[model samples]
Target chain A: MESIQNLLIGFNDIFSVYNMIIIFLGSMFGTIVGALPGLGPSAGIALLIPLTFGMPVGSALSLLVGAYMGTMYGGRITAILINTPGDAPAIMTAQDGYPLMLQGKGGLALGISAFSSFIGGIFGLIVLVFGAPIVSKVAINFGPPEYFMLMVLGLSTITLLAGKSMSKAVMMALVGFALGMVGSDYVSGFVRFDFTPELIEGVDFVAIIIGLYGISEVFLNIENLVHLKMGKPSFKVKEFIPSISDIKKITMPTLRGSLIGTLIGILPGAGGTIATFLSYATEKKIAKNPEKFGNGAIEGLAAPEAANNASVPGALIPLITLGIPGSGGTAIMLGALIMYGLRPGPLLMVESGRLVWLMIAGLIIANVFLLFSNILLIPVFINIIRMIQKYLSPIVTVLCILGAYSLNYGMFNIWIVLIFGVLGYFMKKFDYPSGPLILSVVLAPLTENYFRQSIMLSRGSFSIFLTRPVSLGIILLLITIFAFSFIKKGRNSKNQDYSEE
Target chain B: MKLMERIFIIGMMIFSGLVIYEGIKLPIKSEYTIGPGFLPIVIGIGIFISSISCIVQSVYKYKKLDTDTKFISKEGATRLGIFIAVLTGALLLNEIFGLLISMVVFMIVILRYVEKYSWFVSIRVAIISNIIFYLIFEIWLRVPLPGINL
Candidate 1:
C-alpha cells in the first residue's frame, strides 16, 4: 500500500546514524525540560531551535518532533510525583496521580500512565498516517474561497475558546493581525508598518514566540519558586511494569480517551486541555463507583494521561494536511516547518512528501523511545528536578536570552524578546489568552492573501464565499457556533442571577 | 490592578489609532482586488471596536472585582521586578562583555543576591552553565556567539 511505502520512505530517511542519535538525544533532553515546572513543548522546541539552524532539514525536523513527543511523555512526572502539573493538559493527571502517590501507588501510577501514554500515542499516529493523506487529498481541490472560509473558521474558533472574555480574545487577535501586517505585503508589495529596518522583514513571530512562552514563563516561575516535595525516589523494574489486572483496568479508559483526544484534536483550538477534561468527565460519569473517582482512582489517572498524549499527534493532523495549526504548540511547529523552507498545506505531501514522511517516521520512533526512556530514567529525572530547583530561573533566563540572540546573530531580536516578554507577562497576569493572538499572527498573511485572491476570482463579489458549496458549509457551521455561544452566554448569565437571588 | 488595566486599554486605543492612520495612506485596492491596506485598515477598526467592547465589559466585571485579590504578594512582585530589571541589565551588558560573560554575571547576581545562594554555589553554577553554553553554541553549532569585547 502507498501508506506503507510512504512510511518506508520515512524510515529510509531516518535510519542514518546521525539522524538516529539526534532523535535519541533530543527526546531525552526534551523530557528533562518538560519535567521542569514551567517549560512545555513550545518552550522546549523554541529554546532548542537554534541548535538545528545548520542541520539538514530531515534531521532538524526529526529532532524537533522527538522533543515535542518527549514533552508530552514527560508531563506525567510532575503530576504523579508532585501535585504540580507540568502544563495544562496534565492538570487532570494530578487530580488522581498525586492522590495515588499518597496511597503509596506512585510507582504503579507512573507505570500505568507510561503504558497508556504509549498506546494513546500509537493510536493517534495510526489516525495521523491514514487521516492526513485523506484530508490532504480533499483539501487539494479547495479553491481560494474555501481556503479563506476555512481560515476564518479556524481563527474564529480559537478566539471563541481562547478566554472567558470573547472581547479580549478578539482584541488580542486584532493585535496579532496588526503585528502580522508589519512586513512587505506579498500581493500588493507595499510595506505597512516599516518603522524599523528589521520591520521591513516583518515581525519575526518566532522571536515573539520565544519571548512569550520561554522568557515570560521564567518571569512567572521566579515569582513563586516552590520546591517540589518529592516522594520516595527508588522504583524497581518490577514496580514499573503494570500487572495484568492493572492493564485490564486501564485498557478501556485509555482507548476511550484516545478516541476523544483524536476527534477533539482534529477540531481547531480544541486541543489537549479540553480533550483531557472531557475524557476525565466521561470516565467519572461512567464509573461503577463515582465516589472513588478522584481518590486514587487509576481509571481517573489513566484516561487523562492517555488523552494528553493522544492530543499531541491529533493536533498535528491539521498542520500537516491543511496548514492550519490545531493548538498553541502546533502553531510553533508550523513556524518551524516554514523555517525549514518547506511550505505546509495540501500540496505539502505532493511537494515535500519525502521530508514529511521522514518527520512522521521520526515521530513514531520518538514515541516508542520516550516510553522506555521515561520509565528507566525516572529516578534520574526526579534527581535532576530536585538539584536544579534553586538555579532554574536564572538558567532558563540565560537560555532564553541566548536563544533569541542566536535567531539572527543580532541584538534586534533580543530587544523584541525583552519587550514582548513584558507584554506577555502582563497578558498572562490579566488572564488574556495568548493562543488566539499567536494563531492570528501566524494565519494573518495566509488569510489576507486567500481573501484577496478569492475576491479577484469572483470579480469583487462577496457572494463568492456563499456560492461555493464547501465554503457555504463552513459559513453555516460558523453561524451555528456563534448562535450556540450566544445562547450559552444568556443561560450562564441567568444562572448567575439566580445564584445571586 | 485597576490602574494597570486602565493603562493597557488607553495604550491599545492609541496603538489602534496609529495603525489606522498609517493604513489609510496605502492604497486600499489593486487591479480589482484588495490591497495591503485593506487588511490593516480592517484590523485597525476591529481592534478599535474590540477595545470599546472590552472597556464596557471591564467596567461591569471590575465593579465587584475582589478588592482584596492580590495579583502578586509583595515579596513575589518585588522578586519579579528585580528579575526583569536584572535581565534587562544583562542584555545591555551583552553588548560590552559578550554573551557568555554577561550571562554568567547575570546568573551570579540572581543566585547570590536575589535567591541568596552562597557565593560558592553561585559561582559554581554560573561557570558550569556558561561553559556548557560556550561548548554547545560556540563550538558545536558554529553560531559566532559574541566573545569578550572588553
Candidate 2:
C-alpha cells in the first residue's frame, strides 16, 4: 500500500506530456544505441546525462532510468538476430535465441524476449519499491567470503555448458582463466603478462567476445553457407506472437528468472551475467526436455532475458537504499545521484524519496512503453536481415571489426579480434564450449581478488569460506545443485540405455 | 580431426607449461595475501592436469575414433579462406585508406567475388553501406573511424 502511494506520487510528477515524450524518445534512442555493437548501458547513460543537464531533477532521472532499461532490452536484439551479444549478459540469449533465428523463428524470439524483459522489469521494480531497505541490509552484510562463494557459484555453471566432453570444457575454462589474468595482478599490482603495452590493462573481454561469438560465427556461417537462416519476410501472426502453449511454457521460467535475478543482482559485481547464466542453468536442469536447451528452447530464451532485465531494478536496490552501486551502469547512476545533490546512503530514501520513487515510476512506464515499441518494430528489425541476406557476411564482418576498434579507437583490439576469430573457428570445429571460456574470463580476476581479500581478512585462514554462515550456506547450495545435476545425469544415461535395450 | 585434436592438446600443454614457468618466476606471496603469481600457478596446474586427462581419453579412444569424417566440403574451405583474407586485408588497408575506403573495398571484393554478386550490384551496395556506416559511426556517433580524412 505504501509502495502504491509512493508510486502514485511519482506518477503525478512525471505525468505531463513533455516527460512522457522524453521517456519515450530516451528509451527508443537507447534501444538503437544499445543494439549496436560497442555501446552498452553505461555508454548510453553517460551520453544522455549531459543532454538532461538543465531539466528538472525528476524528469532527468526518469529519462536516464528509461534509457538504462532500454539498453538492457536492446542487447537481446543483436544476440537474437545475429549471434553477437552486445555484452556478456546477452550471451545465453544467443545460445538459444540465435538458434531459434536459425530455425526461422526470429520474430518469435524477439517477441518472447521483449515480453519477458517487460515482466522481469516490472517484477524487479516491485521488489525495489517494497524490498529495497530490507534487501539493502542483506547486500551490505555480504563479506569477502560470501562474495568468493558467489563467484564459485557462478563458475560452477561451467559443467552445465560442457557440451559432450567435460575435460575439453575444463581445458577451455582454464585457458580463459589464464587469459583473464594477463593484466595487472590485483593483489601485488605486478604486471604478469605484459607481452604488449596493452597487456597492462588486461585482455579486453569485449574484443574477445566480438571475435569468439561475432567474428567466428560469421566465419562458420560463410563456411557452412548459412550466414543467417532468414526466411522470406512473413508478417504472419504466429511469426510475431507467441502461441498460448509457448506462453504457458515460458511463464514459470520467467518468474524463476525474475526471482533469481532480484536475489543475485543485489550482490555487487555479480549482476545480470551470473543471474542469466544461473537462470539458464536452472531451467535446463529442471526442464522436461533438457536437450531442447541451447537448441532454440523458448524457455531457455525467455528465462535469461527476464533475468537480464530484472537485474536492472535488482541492481538499483542497493544504490537507492544503501548508496552502493551493484554494477557499472548503477555506478554511473550513483555519480548522477551525487551530481544531482543527492546523498545515496541510508538517508537517501528518507531525504529524496520522491526522486527515487520517480525513477522507479519512470522504469515502470519505460518497460511498458518499450514492450509495445519493440514488438511493433519487430518486422522492421527482422526485415533488415531478410532484405540483405546476400550481403550479411561482409556487413557483419565490418561491424565486428568496427566493434573491436571502437573499444579503444586503436587498431590493436581489431587485431586481437582477428586472431581470436581464427582461434574461435578451431574451437568450434573441435566442439569446445565457448560459454565456459567466456564465463571463466569474466569471473577469474574477480574470484581471485575476492579469495585474496577473504584470506587477508581471516588472517590467512582458508577456512573463512566455510566458517562464515552465508558462505557456508552457499557451499551447501552449490553442493545440492551439483549433486542433483549429477544424479539427474546418471538417471538420464540409464534411461537412454533402457531405451536402447 | 584426430590429428588436429592431438595438436590442440600439445598446444595446450605447451601453453600451460609457459604459464607455470612465468608463475614460478613471479613472487608467490605478498604481505598478508597471496601474491599475483598464485592464481596463475594454480590455473596452470589445473590446465596441465585437465590436458593430461584429455590426452588420456583421446589416446584411449584413438582406435574407435573415425579419422575420415567429413569435416568441411572443399568449396566451403575455399570460401572460408577468401573470407578471412578479405577481412584481414580490409584492416591492413584501413591503415592506409582508413575504415571507409578499406571497408568499401572489402564490400566490393566480398560481394563480387565471395557472394558472386554482379559488379553493378556490388559497387552500388558497397558505396551505400559505407555511407550509412560513416553517417552513423563517424558522423553521428563520432567514432573517429580510421582514415576519416580521406
Candidate 3:
C-alpha cells in the first residue's frame, strides 16, 4: 500500500511542468551527445554537472539521469545507421545494428531496440525502486574491511575482462592507483603527488573523466576522418513500430541482457560497457545459430542496447546504497551529488527517502517518454545521419572541448580531458582496456582511504580484513576468481601451443 | 612499441623509486603504527612490481613477433604524441590565462587546426559556445569561471 502511494506521489512530482521540461531537455541533449561517437554518459553528465547547480536537487538529477539513459538509447542510432559505435557499449550494438542497416531493416532494428530499451529500463527501474532500500540497509553493516574486500573483488573484474593480457590490466590498475594518490592524504593531511599546487585537491574527477572519454575520442575521430562516409537507407513509416515477430525474436535476448545488466549494475566498478559486451556475448553463445548474430539478427541488435539501458539504473543501486559509484558515469553522478551538498549513500536513503524515491520515480517516467520519443523520432534521427560526417565530426570535437571546460568552470580540466583523450587513444592502440583504469580511478581513493583508516584504527592489524565475515567472503571470492582466471589462462596458452604444433 | 615499453618501464621505476623514498621520510609513530608514508610505500612497491612485469611481458612478446614494424608505427605514435602535446598545452595555458580564455582558445585552435575547420566556423563556434557557457555556468549555476575576470 505504501509502495503504491509512494509511486503515486512520484508520478505527481514528475508530472510538474518544470520536471517534465528538465527530463525532455536532458533526454534531447543526452541523445545528441550520445549519438555522436565517443562522448558517453560519463563525459556528458560531468560536463552538465556544473550547469545544473542552481536547480533543485531532484530536478537536476532528473535531467542528468534522463540524459544518462538517453545516451544509452541514443548510441544505437549511430551504431545502426553507421558502422561507428557512439560509445563502447554501443560497439556490441554496431555488430548487429550495422548488419541490420545493411539488410535495409534499420527502421525495424531501431524499433525493436527502442522497445527492448523500454522494457529493460522498466525492469531496472523496478529493481531500483524496490531493491534500493534493502541494498542500502545491507550496506549499513559494511565497515572498512567490507569496503576493502569489495575493492579487491571489483579489481578482480579486470582480470575477468583482460582476456589474454590480465597482467597489463593489473598494471593499468596500479597506474590508476598511483594516479589516485596525486591528492592529499585523508588522514595525516600529507600531499603525495602534488608536485604543483594545482594537484593539491588531487586529480579532479571531471578532469580525468573528460581527458579519458572526451579528448581521446576526439583524436580517434580526427584520425578516422578519411573513413567518414555515410550509408543511405530509406525508412518505412509503418515499420517504425516493431512487429509481433520482431518482438518474439528479441524477447529472450532482451530478458537475458536485462538480467545480466541489472546484476552488473548492482556491482561496483563494472559499468555499461562490460554489461553490454557480456550480454551480447552471452546472447550470441546461447543463440541456436550464432553465425546470424553479427549478420543482422534482431536479437543481436536488441540484447546489448537493452542491457546498456538496464545497466544505467542498475549502477545507481550501489551509488545510492554504499555511496560507492559502480562505474565512471555513476562516479560523475556521485560527484554531482557531492557538489550539490547531498550525501549519497545509505544515509541518503535513510535521511532523504523522498528524494531517492522521487529520483527512481522520475526514471520510470523518463523511460516512458524515451520509448515514445524513440519510436516517433526514428525517421528524423535517421535523416540527421544523412548529413556529412566530416562536418558533424568537427562539431562533435568542439562539443567535447566545451563539455570538458564546463566542468569545474575551469580550462585546466579541458586540458586534462585533452591529455586523457590522447592517453585513451594510445591505451586503445596498445590493446589495454580503459575501463579498468577508469574503475580504478573511481574506486582507488576510496579503497586507499578506507584501507588506511581501517588499518590506523586497528593499529596496523591486517587480520581485520579476514575476521569480518562479509569482508572475508568478498576476499575469498576475489581469490577464487583469481584462481579461476589463472587456470583459464593456462588452458588458453596450452591451446595456443597445441594449435602451433 | 618495444622501445616505448622500455621507456615507460624505466620511467615507472624512477617515479616509483622517488615515491618510495619520499614516503619513507614521513614521521612514524611506532613500528606498529601505520604512518602517512605506509600507503605510499605500498603503492610504490606495487608500481615497481607492475612495471617489472610489463617490461618482462614486452620483452617476451617482442621476441615472439616479427621485428619488421618500426617501434610503434610512426604515424600512430605521432598522432598520439600530438594529442598529448595539445592536452598538455591546454593545461599550461589554463594556468597562465585562466580557465575560460585558455579553453575557448584551445577549442577554437583544435577545431580549426587539427580538425581543419574554417576560421569563420571556428570563431563562430567559439563565440556562440562562450555565450551559452556564460549563461549556463555564470548566470544559472553561479560557478566562478577562471580566465574571464576582464
Candidate 4:
C-alpha cells in the first residue's frame, strides 16, 4: 500500500509541465544521439549532462534517466537500417535485424524490436522498484567494513570482466585509483598530490568523463571513417505490428531475455552488451531451428533487444541501493547524483524517497515514451543519421570542449580533458579497457574513506574487516571471483597454445 | 602492439616507483588510522606488481608467437599527429583568441583538411555549429565562453 502511495506521489511530481517537457526532449535527443555510430549511451549522457545543470534535481534526473532508457531502444534503429549498430549492445541486433531488412521486413523488425524493448524495460523497472528497496533495507545495517569490502568486490569484478588481459585492466584500475587520490584528503585536509591549485578540489569528474569517452571516441571515429550508405527505410503503418503467430513466437524469448538481462545487469561490470550476447546465444541454443537464428529470425531480434533494454534498469539497482554502480552508464549517473549533492546509498531512499521514487517512475514513463517515440519518429531518426554522419566528428569535438569547459568555467579543466583525451586514445589503441579505469576513479575515494573509517573504528586493527560477517562474505566472494578469473585465463591460454600448434 | 605493450609495462613500473617514493614522504599512518599516503602506497604497489606480471606475460606470449601484425601505417601515424596538433592548437588558442574563434578555426581545419570536405561545406558547418554552440552555452545555459575583450 505504501509502495503504491509513494509511486503515486512520484507520478504527481513528474507530471509537472517543466519535468514532462524535459523528459520528452531528453528522450528525443537520446534516440537521435544513440542512432549515431560510436557515441553510445555513456557518451550521450556525459555530453548532455551540462544542459541539465540548471534544472532541479528531479527534473534533471528525469531528463537524464529518460535519455538513458531512450538510448537502449534507439540503438536498434540504425542496426536495422544501416547494418551499423549505434551502440555496442545493438551489434547483436544488427546481425539479424540487417538480414531482416534485406528481406524487406525492416519495418516489422523495428516494430518487434521496439515492442520487445518496451517489455524488457518494464520488466527491468519492476525488478528495480521491488528489488532496490529490499536491498537497501539489508544494506542499511552495513558499516564501513562492509562498504569497503563491497567496493573491493566492485573493483575486482570490473577488472575481471573489463578486458581480455586481467593485468592490463588491473593496471588501468590502479592508475585510476592513483589519479583519484590526487586531491586534498577529506578527513585530514592534507594535500596528497596537488601539482596545481585546481588539484586541491580533485579533478573534475565531468572533465575526465568528457575527455575519456567523448573526445577519445571522436579521435577514434575520425581515424576510421566508414561511409555508410543511408538507404531509405521501407515502412507501412499497417505492417508495423507483428502478426499473432510472430508475437507468440517472441513472447517466450522476450520473457527469458528480460529475466537474463535483469540478472546480469545486477552484477557489477557485466552490462547490457554481455546480457545481449548471452541472451542471443541462449535463444539460439534453445531454438528448434538453430541454423535460422541469425538469418532474419524474429526470435534473434527480439531476445537481444529485450535483454539490452532490460539491463538499463537492472544496472541501476546497485547504484540506488548500495551506492555502487553496476556499469559505466550507472557510474556516470552516480557522478551526476553526487554533483546534485545527493549521496546515493541505503539512506538515499530514507532521506530522499521522493527523488528515488520519481526516478523510478520517470524510467517507466520514459520507456512508454520510447516505445511511441521510436516508432513515430523512425523516419525522422533515419534522416538524422544521414545529416549527423558528415559532421559527427567536428560536432563531437566542439561538444567535448564545451562540456569540459562548462564544468567550472576554467581553462585548467579543458587542459585536463585534453590530457586524458590523449591518454584514453592510447588506452583504446592498445586494447586496454577504459571502463575499469573510469569505474576505479569513481569508486576509489569511497573505498578509501571506508577503509580509513573502519581502521579508525577498530583502533588501527585490520581485523575489523574480517570480523563482520557481511564484510567477510564479500571479501570471500572477491577472492573467489579473482581465483576463478585466474584459472579460466590459464585454461584459455593453454587452449590457445594447443590451437596454435 | 607487442612492443608498445612492453614499453607501457616498463613505463607503469617506473611510474609506480615514483608514486611509492612520493608516498613514503607523506605520513603513512595516523594516530587513529591510516593516513592519505596509505592508498597511494597501496595502489602504487599494486601497479608495480601488476606491471611486472604484465611484462612476464608479454615476454611469454612473445616467445610463443611469431610477430605477424603491423601496428600502424604511415598514413595513420600522420593522421594521428595532425589530429593531436589541431587539438593542442585549439587548447592554446582558446585563451588568447577566445573559444568561439579557436573552435571555429579548429572545426574548419578538421572539416576541410582532415575530413576532406569542400571549402564551402566546411565554412558552412563551422559557422552553423559556432552559432548553435554560442546560443546554447552562452545564452541558454549562461556559461561564459572565453571571449576577446572589445
Candidate 5:
C-alpha cells in the first residue's frame, strides 16, 4: 500500500504541466537524434545536457530519462529502414529488420520493434523498482573494503566484456585511470599531473564524453563520407499493424529477451549490446525454424529490440542503487545526477525517495508515450530523417564544439574535445573499445578513494579486503573472470595454431 | 597495421614508464597509509604489463595483422588531415571571431568543400543552423556563448 502511494505521488509529480511538456519534447527530440546515424544515446544525452542547466532537478531528470527511453526505440527506425544501425545495440535489429524492410514489410517491422521495446522496457522497470532496493540494502552494509572490491569488480567486468581482446581493454581502462589521476588527489590534496592550470580541476567528464563519442564519431563518419548511403524507405501507414500470426510468433521471443536482458543488465559492464546479441543467439538456437532468422524473421527483430530496451532499465539498477553505471548512457546520466548535486548510491534512495520515484515514474510514463507516439509519428520520424540526413555531420560538429564549450565556458574544454576526439578516432581505428575507458574514468575517483580509506581503516593492512566476506567474494569473482578469459584465449590460440599446420 | 600496432605498444610502454617515474616522486606512503601515488603506480605497472602482452600477441599473430590497413587509402588520409586542419582553424577562429561567425564559416567550408554539397545548400544550412543555435543556446538556455555584441 505504501509502495502504491509512493508510486501515485511519483506519477503526480511527473504529470505536472512543465514536466509533462519537457518529457514530450525530449522524447520527440531524442527519437530524431537517435534516428540520425553516428549519434547514439550517450552522445545525444551529452550534447543536450547543457540545455537542462537552469531547470529544476526533477524536470531535468524527467527530460533526460524520456530522451534515454526514446533513443532506445528511435534507434530501431534507421536500423529497419536504412539498413544502417543508428546505434551499436541496434545493429542486431538491422540484421533481420532490413531484410523485413526489403520484403516491403517495413511498417510491420517498425511496429513489432516498437511493441517489443515497450514490453521489454516495462518489464525492465518492474525489475528495477524491486531489484534496486534489494541491491541497495545489500550494498548498505559495505564498508570501504567492500566498496573498493566492488569498484575493482566493476572495472574488471567492463574490461572482460569490452570486446574480443582483453589486453586492449585493460590498456584503455588504464589510460582512463591515468587521465583520472591528472587532477588533485581527494584524500591528500596533492596534485599529481597538473601540468596546466586547466588540468588542476581534472578533465571535465562532459568534455571527454563529447570528444570521445560525439566528435570522434563525426571524424569517423566524415572519413567514410565518400561511401555513405542513405536508403529510401517506403511503407503504408495502414500496414503498420502486425498480424495475429506475427504477434503470436514474437510474444515468446520478446518475453525471453526481456528476461535475459534484465538479468544481464544487472551485471556491471554487461550492457544492451551484449544483452541483445545473447538474446538473439538464444532465440536462434531455440527456434524451430532457426534458418528463418536474419531473413525477415519476426523472432530476430523482436528478441534484440526487446533485449536492448529492457537493458536500459537493467543498467539503471546499478547506477541508482550503487552509483556504478553499467553502460555509457547510464554513465552520462550519472554525470548528470552528480551535476545536479545529488550523490547517487545507497543513501540516495533514503535521502531522496521522492525524486528517485519520480524519475522511475517518468521512465514508465515515457515508455507509455513512446509506445503510442512511435506508431503515430512513424511518418513524421521518416520525414525528419530525410530532411536531416544531409546536414547531420556539420550539425553534429557544431553541437560537439558548443557542447564542450558550454560545459565550462572555456576554450580549454574545446581543446580537450579535440585531443580526445583524435584519440577516440585512433582507438576506434585500432579496434580498441572506448566503453571501458569512459567507465574507468567515471569509477576511478571512487575506487581510489575507497582503496585509500580501506587501507587506512585496516591500519595499512591489505588483508582487510580479503577479511570481509562480501569483498572477498567480489575479489574472487574478479579473479575467476580473469582466469576464465585467459584460459579461453589460450585454448583458442592453440586451436588456431593447430589449424595453421 | 603491424607497424602502427608496434608503435602503439612502444608508445604505451614509454607512457606507462613516465607515469611510474612521476608517481614515484609523490609520497608512496603517507602517515603509514597508502598515498595518492599508489594507485597510479599500480595502474602504470598494469599498463606496462598489458602493453608488453599486446606486443607479444601481435608478434604471434603477425600474419593476421598484415591484412589490416590503418587508413582506407592515401586520399582518405589526406582528407582526414584536411578535416583536422579545418577543425583547428575553426578553434582559432572561435577565439578571434567568436562562436557564431566561426561556426558559420566552419559549416560552409565543411558542407561545400568537404561534403561536396552545392554552395547554395551549404550557405542555407550554415545560416539556418546558426540562427537556430543562437536562439536555442543564447536566448532560451541563456548560455553565454562568445558572440557578436549584437
Candidate 6:
C-alpha cells in the first residue's frame, strides 16, 4: 500500500508538462544517437550531463533516464535494418535479426523486439517500484566489509569460465583489477605506482572504458575493413504482428530473459551482456526445438533484446539504492546524477523520496515512448539506412568520435576513443569479451576502495567478513556459484564426450 | 598475447615490489596496526599473487595445448600495441600543448595518418569538431579553454 502511494506520486510528478517534454526530447535524442553505430547509453548520458547541470535533480535525472532507456531500445532499429549492430548488446540481435531481414521479416522482428522491450522494461520497473525501498534498506546496512564481499562476489560471478576455461576469465579480471589499482590510495592519500601527475589523479574511468570497449572494437573492425562495405540491406515488411505460433514460441523466452536481466542488473557490475548470454544459453538448454538457435530463430532475437533492455532498469536498482553502478550505462547515469548535484546512494531515497519515485515514473513513461516511437519509425529507420555506405559510414564515424569526445571536455579523450576503438577491434577478433574487461575496469575502484577500507577497519583481521552476516552470506554465495560451476562443467565434459562419440 | 601477458605480469610484479620497498620507509610497529604502508603491502601482496598465478596459468596452458595453438595472433597483438602507443601519445601531447591545439592536431594526425583518412576529410572533421568543442565547452558551458599556445 505504501509502495502503491509512492508510485501514484511518481506518476503525478513524472506526468508534469516539463518532465514529459524532457522525456520526449531525451527519447528522440537518444534514438538518433543510439541509431548511430558504436554510441550507447554511456556516450548519450555523458554527452548530455552538462545540459542537466542547472536543472532540478528529479527533472535532470528524468531526462537522463529517458535517454538511457531510449538508447538501448533505439539501438535495435539500426541493428535490425542494417547488418551492423548499433552497440555491443545489439550484436546478438544482428546475428538472427540480419538473417531475418535478408529473408524479409525485418519489420516483424523489429516490432517483436520493440514490444518485448516495453514488456521487459515495464516488468523491470515494477520490480524497481515494489522492491527498491526494501533493497535500499538492506543496502544501507552494508559497511565496508559487506561492500567488499559483495564486490568480490560480483567479480567472481563474471569470472566464470568462457568458452574454454574459467582460468582465462580470471586472468583477464586480475589484469583489469591490477590496472584499476594504478592511482591514488583512497585511505592514506599516498599515491602508489603513479609515475606521472596525470596518472596520480588515476586513469579516468571514461578513458579506460572508451579504450577497452570502444577503441578495442574499432581495431577489431579494421581487420575486416577491406572485405566489408556498408550499404543498407533491403527488406520490406507487409505485416508487423507476430503470429499466434510465433507469439507462443517467444513468450517464455522473453519472460525468462526479463528475469535473467533483472537479476543480473541488481548485481553490481553484471551488465546486459551477461544477462543476455545467460538467457540465450538457458533458452538453448531447455528449448523443445533447440536446433534453430543460431539459425534465425525468433526466440534468439526476442530473448536477448528483451534481456538487454530489461537490464537497464535492473542496473538502475543498484545505482539508486547502493550508489553502485551495475554497468557502464549506469555509471554514466551516476555521473549525470552527480552533475545534477544529487549523489546516488542510501540517503538519496530518504532525502529525496519524491525525486526517486519521479525518476521511476519517468522510466515507465520512457518505455511507453520507446514502444510507440520504435514501431511507428521502423519503416523510416529502414528507409534512411538505404543511403550509400560512403555517406553513412563517415557520418557514423564522426558521430562515434564526437560522442566519445563530448564525455569530458578533453580532446585527449578523442585519442582514447580512437585507441580503444582499435583495441576493441582486436579483442573482438579474438574471443575475449571486451565486456568483462570494461566491467572489471569500471568496478575496480569500488571493489578496491571498499576492500581497503574494510581491511583498515578490521585492523588486518580477515574475521570481519565472517562477523557480518550479509558479507558472510555473499561470500558463501560466491563459493556456491563456483562449486556449482565446477559440478556443471564436469557434467558438461561428460556430455561433450558423448556428443563427440 | 603470451609475450604481452608475461611482460605485463613481470612489470606489475616489479612495480609492486617497488611500492612495498617504499612502504618499508614508513614505520610500522605491528602487523595489525593501520599505517601508511598497510594498504600498500596488501596491494603489493595481491599483485605478487596474481602475477605468479598468471605465469603458472600461462605455463599450464602451454603444456596442455598442442604446439599449433595460437593464443593471440601476431597481427592482433601488434595492432593492440599501436593502439596503446597512440593513447600514450595523446596523453603526452595533452600535457605538452594544452587542450585545444593539441586536440585539433591530435584529431587531424590520427584520423588522417593512423586511420588513413584523406587529408581533406581529416581537415574537415578536425575543424568542425574543434568548433563544436569551442561552443559546447567555452561558450555554452562556460568552461574556460586551456591556453593552447603555451
After superposition, the stretches of candidate 3 with alpha carbons farther than 4 Å from their true spots are A1-15, A161-164, A231-236, A267-294, A323-326, A334-346, A382-415, A456-460, B28-33, B68-113, B116-131, B138-150
Ranking by TM-score: 1, 4, 5, 3, 6, 2
In angstroms, the error of model 6 at A107 is: 1.9
Candidate 2, after superposition: displacement of residue A48 in Å? 16
After superposition, candidate 1 runs with Cα above 4 Å error: B66-68
Tens digit of lDDT per residue, candidate 2, span A1-501?
Answer: 877898899899889898898899789767765665545676567556545555789888988988999888888887988787766788999999999988989889998999999899889888888887565456556777887786676566666656677798889889989998998875677898788998899887767766776577667777877644544445554576788999999999999999898888876556788999999999999999999998999999999989999999998876677555555567567657866888665567677888888888899999999998888875664565355556766776777777666667888988998888877888888788776776677667767878989999988888898888989998998898779768877888799889979
Ranking by lDDT: 4, 1, 5, 2, 3, 6
**Model number with the top DockQ:** 1
Question: TM-score for each prediction?
Answer: 0.97, 0.70, 0.86, 0.96, 0.94, 0.76
lDDT of each: 0.85, 0.80, 0.73, 0.85, 0.85, 0.68
TM-score of 1: 0.97
- Give me the displacement of residue B79 in model 6, in angstroms: 8.7
Give the local distance difference test score of model 6.
0.68
Q: What's every prediction's RMSD, in angstroms?
A: 1.7, 7.9, 3.8, 1.8, 2.3, 5.3
How far off is residue A187 in model 4, in Å?
1.5
Ranking according to DockQ, highest score first: 1, 5, 4, 2, 3, 6
Chain B of candidate 6 versus the native chain B: what TM-score? 0.74
Q: Cα deviation in Å at residue A5, candidate 2?
A: 8.7
Tens digits of per-residue lDDT, candidate 6, A1-501, equal 888899899898777788888898788767765766766777666555555644677777888888988888877777776677777678878777778877878878887888778878887888888788988877776688887776676566554424455544554555455556567766666665566666676555555565554445344433323222334534344356678888898898899888888888787666777777787888888888889877778898888888888888888887788676656677556645654556567667887788889888899898998888777766655444343122332333433444455555566556656655654554454344444454566567777667667877898887888998888888888888879878989999899889979
Ten residues in sequence with the least summed lDDT for candidate 5 chain A: A226-235
lDDT of predicted model 4: 0.85
Q: List the residue pairs that clash in candidate 3.
A: A210-A417, A211-A417, A211-A420, A211-A421, A215-A421, A216-A421, A269-A326, A411-B99, B1-B71, B1-B72
Residue A38 in model 2: lDDT: 43
The sequence of per-residue lDDT tens digits that candidate 5 reaches over residues A276-321 is 9999999999999999999999999999999999998999998888
After superposition, which runs of candidate 5 have C-alpha atoms over 4 Å from their true positions? Answer: A226-228, A231-233, A491-501, B65-72
lDDT of 3 by residue, A275-308 (tens): 8889999998988999998898889878888888
What interface RMSD does candidate 3 have? 3.7
Model 5 superposed RMSD (Cα): 2.3
Please give the lDDT score for candidate 2.
0.80
